[model samples]
Target: MESWELGEWYGEFLDALNRHDLEAVRSLIDPGVRRAHLPRGGEAWIADLGEFFHAFPDWRWKRIQLVIEDDRIAAHLRGSGTHSGHYRDIAPTRRHVNVAEFAIYRVTNGRIAEFSGSSDAELRAQLA
Candidate 1:
């Protein structure tokens, strides 16, 4: 896909994520989308993302930078939210967090096929 087209696709996906719109995600992601380098696939990944909204009702994803090559898109992003519920066994601290990550996404025919990313370490340290 062209850079502009890829950017547009990636942008819509990000917009859906930031909106916590699972229906849009379901439409944009392949039924067998991979997660975090895992073989885990299928539509089940939808709820996996919902965990974030469960923990941070106001969660948002912001794009910092993006580079597109063919069907792959790499994005540098910022994620922020307030801890209003338990997250990964951590009790709610009501703390607001801003974290950074570099994510690489693979898209095929406009649907996301795979995604892998890592976020700032300090964000976890702050939780501890």
Candidate 2:
């Protein structure tokens, strides 16, 4: 896809994600999308989000920037939400938090094929 088209595609996916629409999110991903750096499939990706969204009921992802290079899309984003549910072994703080993140996503055939991301150092300290 062209850079502009790919950006639009990601925008739509993010919109669906913000709305917490699982079906819409699924529509934008490949059936075999990789999770983390593992070989797991799209369901794993979806399940991971399920956990994240559960922890942050009002989770919001705002795209700060998007750069399309070849088949990869790099994104700079900010996320904020109230930690009101279980996250891993950490009990809910019920406290609002914000974090910045950067991610590189590979798209194949108009669907996300692979993704890797990192959050700001402050996120770790804040969560701790």
Candidate 3:
């Protein structure tokens, strides 16, 4: 895909996520998607996203920048959310937190086939 298309695609993906539409998010992800810090494949990643949304129902991501190289796209993002639900072992603090996140994703056949990037540690720390 062209660079502009990749940006649009990622924008849509983030839109779906911010809307908490897991099914829409899943539709854009390859079933065999590979993830660096989580269990491999889309289902596992989708499940993780589900948990994240539950913890931060008002979560939103703001794109800071994107660098595209062929099928790989790296994104720098600012994510913010309200801690209104349990996250891992931490109880909800009702705190609103903002965190920086960077992620790299490989697109194949117009779908996200692989990805890896930021962890929840930063957000968790803020909540703590």
User: Which candidate's lDDT is highest?
Assistant: 3
lDDT scores of the candidates, listed in order: 0.85, 0.85, 0.93
- Candidate 2 lDDT over 1-128, as tens digits, reads 98889999889988998998878888888888875755477788788788888998999999999999878999999989988998777789888889988988999998898888884356546768
Clashing pairs in 2: none
Residue-level lDDT of model 3, residues 56-123, one tens digit each, is: 99999999999999999999999999989988898999999999999999999889999999887898
What is the TM-score ranking, best to worst? 3, 1, 2
Cα-based RMSD of candidate 2: 1.7
- lDDT over C-alpha atoms for residue 112 of model 1: 83
Candidate of highest TM-score? 3
TM-score of each: 0.91, 0.91, 0.96
Q: Kindly list the per-residue Cα lDDT of model 1 for residues 41-125, writing each as its tens digit.
A: 6466777678768989998989999999988999999899998988877889999998887898899988888888884366677
Q: Model 2: runs farther than 4 Å from truth?
A: 119-124
By lDDT, is 2 or 3 better? 3
